[model samples]
Target: MTRTAILVGITMNQVNFDYSMEELANLAEANLIEPVGVITQKIDRTNKATYVGKGKVDEIKGLADYEDVDLVIFNDELSPSQIRNLEELLEIEVMDRTRLILDIFADRAKTREAQLQVQVARLKYELPRVVGQGEGMDQQSGKGGLKNRGAGETKLEMDRRRIKQQISQLNKELDSLVAERQVQRRNVRKMKSQLCPLLAIPMLESLRL
Candidate 1:
């Protein structure tokens, strides 16, 4: 039999995140991810580097070990460095808020355009951190170029180059798609101009009330 692990979520929002966290754990369970624990940090704002506080992160790591958990998930977008740091410290698979939503969106994207849009958004979110990580690799590599590099190329340089190329390609594709969308939007505006209201439908409903 497979060993089960825990699901962890930390969110700064205190209002409606509780129900979402429970739902997420259920989804994880359905995927055979054992819900060992969840740690939430209800703060006014999310931390920039860690998302959660360092103190909270350490606490979660401890809980994971105590629970014998194999994974950790965050309820907010985490920088790439945040992922690297958490994975290094916890020795577990770590995923952020964006990744979870991206997984759900990818599965639900039926149209070719929808699929491409999701791909572009995911890559754009990832590219910055991939580039940022290369800075750390550069320091470790010292003066050496590709020879002292990691994997095939210098770790820092390679990730930067690859991410740059991918981002450029994705941008070109998105630009073409956006151009098509502009034409469609114009057509819709012309046809719906007579029926289009000045304000949002929700605001109109409130007025009716």
Candidate 2:
């Protein structure tokens, strides 16, 4: 199913703002998202909290509500707080350009290595954004006993740990793959070195004659 989206951007002395927004729209379409509208603000700087001016955010919210857009995509990478704030205010899914590009790469990844690299990048991007949620993190529960280390860990904590572990594992795997390629390349060079002497023998004989 094609999801409708609205593209938003902030132009802060950017010479290629129009081209970047156009590329963002193309990216959305590539990810099976239909861009229904475009919104841009000419500002000296982005809002620290919302990544856009408050008034611009309000206008985006209204336009999104009216257009019934399923998602709003920003032309720049947004901080986790910005994403959280925008989603809260707009009541819709929000994605930044970095995430959109990653999604496209994920979808287009045909090889295992490509997929793993994408996963690694995504996990790294999400590592810092992981935060505790609701009563799950606050409530103290002792399923084993009273000696289970404080509140027995929250879902957010677990998520962060899991992502870190995955990132480490993926990095190791990527390194191993790269090492294997290097070894293969060395072997190929060795073979080429041996073949070069053999080929040179005939050329040298012809030159002597």
Candidate 3:
């Protein structure tokens, strides 16, 4: 099913700002996510907390609610704190161009090698963000409102550990596959070298005649 999303970006007077936003919409389409609305901020710099100014963040929140989007897609990659802050204010699933690209790569990965590479890239990308997510949760867990804070921390720890383990395993598999390919390539080269002398014998005889 096609999901709808709001496209968000901040333009710092860059020449390629328009092109980048257009590409983001195209990426959303490629991921089966329809671009229902677009929200852009023209600023000299990004908001360190939300990647957009407070006013622009509110605007995006309104648009997300109005469009009832499944997620909001940012034109650039957002920092983990920025993502957390934006999601908190917007109250919607947030995505960035980097994650969207990774999702597309994952969807198109057909071979085991390609899949392993994608998985590793994704895990690496997620590892830091997971820490960012845990930061806020861990802080809130001490408060009276969040009683199950310990459970949440435990789960986050498990997630972090699991991601690390998966990344390590995938890397090992990739290394093994790469080594196997290297050996195969060496064998092919050796065979070609052995056949070259035989090939040259016929050429030498023809030259003599």
- Candidates' TM-scores? 0.60, 0.85, 0.82
Which of the two, 1 or 2, has more TM-score? 2
The sequence of per-residue lDDT tens digits that candidate 1 reaches over residues 1-209 is 33355555665555778887887776665445677777766677666766677888788888888988767877556788778877877888887657767766776799767887788777777766664454644445355656654434455666767767876887788788889999999999886885566456768899999
lDDT (0-100) at residue 194 of candidate 2? Answer: 96
Arranged by lDDT with the best first, the candidates are 2, 3, 1
Q: Is candidate 2 or candidate 3 better by lDDT?
A: 2
- Per-residue lDDT of model 2, residues 102-164, tens digit only: 999999999878999999999999887776672244434555444565757667777888999
- Error (Å) of candidate 3 at residue 34 is 1.5
> Model 1, residue 57: displacement in angstroms?
3.0
Per-model lDDT: 0.71, 0.89, 0.88
After superposition, which runs of candidate 2 have C-alpha atoms over 4 Å from their true positions?
A: 134-136, 139-151, 199-209
Stretches off by above 4 angstroms in model 1 are: 1-5, 10-13, 26-34, 42-49, 53-55, 131-155, 174-209
Winner by TM-score between candidate 3 and candidate 1:
3
Evaluated against the true structure, the overall lDDT of model 1 is: 0.71
Report the poorest 10 consecutive residues by lDDT, candidate 3: 136-145
Considering TM-score, which of the candidate structures 2 and 3 is the better prediction for this target? 2
Model 3: lDDT of residue 182: 99
